[model samples]
Target chain A: MSAFWIATIGTSVIAFVLKYSGHSVPERWLSHPKIQRINALIPIALLSALVAVQSFSEKSQLMIDQRLVGLSVAMIALFLKAPFPLVVLSAAVSSAAVYHWL
Target chain B: MAFGAAAVANGFSVLQACLLSLLTFSGASQFAVVGVIGAGGSSISAIATASLLGTRNALYGVIMAPRLNVRGFKRVVAAQVTIDESTGVALGQEQRGIDAVKKGFWYTGIGVFVFWNLFTLAGALGAQAMGDIRAFGLDSAVPAAFLGLVWPRLTGKFERILAVSCALFAIAMTPILPAGLPIIATAFIAIVIGMKR
Candidate 1:
């Protein structure tokens, strides 16, 4: 599991930088609305990249897996404004049922 | 959460499973790595596989650094606690922040960290007795946890739309892509959408 730890440490350090960098480093706050808007996009940009990578890739293959299904169910739950716990449970149950059956 | 659940399902001893949680501390990474090793992959391959899936945590750091800049001992500890939920929560408070805004961030980040790991151990310990735990349908716990993390941040149409789109993208891609890459794609879509605006 050294790989796990390596990724953990590697990912943690980067996450720290992204999550805290704006507040941590004493960069002069930009007054430009455009710059502010662009900067604002950074977190969302990174978040999407991160989530997409995690959701789609696994074992270095490109097969549709249960995670995808579970995540889809999760999306539906969220759209319905289901409570967070319920969304999660629904996703898991749907994915598991689908995975087991198929 | 899924890591521990998968471990139990695969018949690992409680001790081994708990140790995975305590030490590995990575949900997807641990789950993916173990599956490979269990399938007879070499240590190197398993490690590489897990590392590949875990690359996002690093990006999390880059996103988190601005929100939490603790130094010295606390910095180190805070660094450890930085994960998906914590980083998102911390950053979500940026525009209309309050006194407890910082506290809210920390609560999300560190709180989830300690409890996730703790409950991970709890599940691992229950492995032996959790036979047929699938009946309880514990597999959904990770997604549930993700929802918990993402739910609180659903403030705007953009954020909500991004989240829903990504979730759907992840699910749709599940049958098409490899294991962990769906989330990556979803993340990319969100980023593009955010940048396009």
Candidate 2:
């Protein structure tokens, strides 16, 4: 199978296992304060990393371009508590303008 | 829909994107998969990052399991829909009693499932028709989506600081490490801080 297919299918299976395990496992195992705290932080860390990587990097090279504008606009929209779709749309619109015009 | 467009922009087939929504059903993890693979990362890296993001669903499962009290196939179905929205809606109906909780869970879970899948298909098809996705700035939309996901979760000073630090740390590591490794590495920072507290 192609790498994309492998990643797509592999991720789906792992995601299911994770969700199913939650229903089957004893509450105490995952409910510990430390474990909960770590679980909460995991997304925050990963998502933040994602934003940085997607915005500033281009395949192991740090390059700045239109994406930085997109990200900054996203942050501003987020600050104003714009709905999710609007925040994303504004960023895309702004960034696309930069990509085409500049 | 954003996922559909983003997945297409990231080189996934419409079928692949729809499959992800149908099976995985977790927004952040699904996004992580496309983001990692799109950036030229290996499948293993994509799976790891997606799984890490998925750990919370297990916690949601724990919260919903007893309340749901299902068995056999019903239990399986419950587990599949045990996401943040379902659990939150279920919990929010606490004062309304058990019947309301069950109703809330089912309605919200199934509702989101149907709409999310349909929109994903729509987004995928739409993106495919758009031809040059970069012209629409869909590439930037992916990161913006990530920002939107994490934005509401940063509810405190410590969390805000840690998230910013992790972002900076990942960017710093991006030049030195491979595509997905930098994101995975930031998990250690969170683990360390989480363990310290």
Best DockQ among the predictions, by candidate number: 2
lDDT per residue for candidate 1 within A2-55, as digits (tens), equals: 443443344434434433343343444433454445434433432343344344
DockQ of each: 0.20, 0.87
For model 2, residues B93-141, the per-residue Cα lDDT tens digits are 9999999999999999999999999999999999999998878989899
What is residue B129's positional error in candidate 2, in angstroms?
A: 1.5
Deviation in Å, model 1, residue B93 alpha carbon: 11
Docking class of 2: high
Q: Relative to the unseen true structure, what is the C-alpha lDDT of residue B44 in candidate 2, on a scale of 0 to 100?
A: 91
* Candidate 1 TM-score versus the reference: 0.52
Prediction 1 global C-alpha lDDT: 0.53
Residue pairs with colliding backbones in model 2 are: none
By lDDT, the best candidate is: 2
